[model samples]
Target: MLEVKNLYKEFNNRPILKDISFTLKDGEIMTIVGPSGAGKTTLLRIIAGLETKDSGEILIDSQAYDSGKVGVVFQDYNLFPNLNVLQNITLAPTMVLKESKEEANKKAYELLNRLQMNGREKQYPYELSGGQKQRVAIARALAMKPRILCYDEPTSALDPNLRKEVEKMILGLKKSGLTQLIITHDLQFAENVADQMLKVQPLSEG
Candidate 1:
């Protein structure tokens, strides 16, 4: 289970998140909805250990939040512009996890196939469409095999048709029993994929 209690965050003395609390059970999908500046991404960053909370606690399965235990698919996809799809996905597994090149390539092949990105392995990020790039990003995250996956603004850059496709992909992940946290402004996408919904109200200044 993932549990966050009384989380607080501030940047340059300006509070972005305050008193945030939530829990996500294993294999559950949670969608966080809020306005653009309401810190939805910040919350996900905190959970993924990319950013630190000023106060409170985050626990994953009763242990402290560890970077190795969570994976994040950033809003911009964040794939390496110079790396081909296969290289992009395999980089972290080999560099961070120290998996052998052969093992990493095998895992990347499986993930690419599962994400329906088989033929695009040799293509760089620029050669792919927005949806394809996002899929590569997701594949990269899954390559880490983290216990929890978090997506920020996953559908923001996609058209309606692509949004639906991504939505289906998320549902597929759920069926695979992966615990997920999605931060999206798309209500329909949220409704389709979220097992639970969280609304992060804008923090009021005193």
Candidate 2:
């Protein structure tokens, strides 16, 4: 289980997220939805340890949160233009975990196959379609074997058909017992995949 209590954040002393709290159970999908500037992305960043929270606590399965346990897929997919799909997926594992390159490559290939990206391992990001790029991003995250995966605006760049495909993929991951946290403005997409929905509002300056 992932539990967040009284999470708070601000930029330049202007509040972004205030008193945010929620709990997401194991193997379930939680979607956070709100209008732009509601700090939805910030909240995900905080959880992923890309940004700091001013107060409160984040715990995973009764232990304190560690960024290593969280992996985030940014809205843009964030694939390296210079790296081929295989390199992109294997980079973190080899560098961070200090795993042998061969070991990382083996796991990367498995992840690619699972994500339906097998033959494209040698292709660069520029050669991939939007949906394919998203798959690569997901593969990259999954290669890390994170306990929790967070997505920011996952369907923002896709058409309705692609959105449905992503919904199916997320649901498939649930069956494999991976906890997911998604931040998106598309309520319909959120409704389709989320086991729980969280609505957030922007804080008022006044």
Best by lDDT: 2
On residues 58-173, what C-alpha lDDT tens digit does candidate 2 reach at each position?
99888988889998888999999999999999999999989899999999988888888889989999999999999999989988889999999999998877888999999988
Clashes of each: 0, 0
Q: How do all models score by TM-score?
A: 0.96, 0.97
Candidates in order have lDDT scores of: 0.91, 0.93
Per-residue C-alpha lDDT of model 1 across residues 38-119, encoded as one tens digit per residue: 9998899888877878999999899977878898999899899989999999999999899999999999999989899898
TM-score of 1: 0.96
Model 1: lDDT of residue 106: 96
Off by over 4 Å in 2: none
Clashing residue pairs found in predicted model 2: none
Alpha-carbon RMSD, candidate 2? 1.0
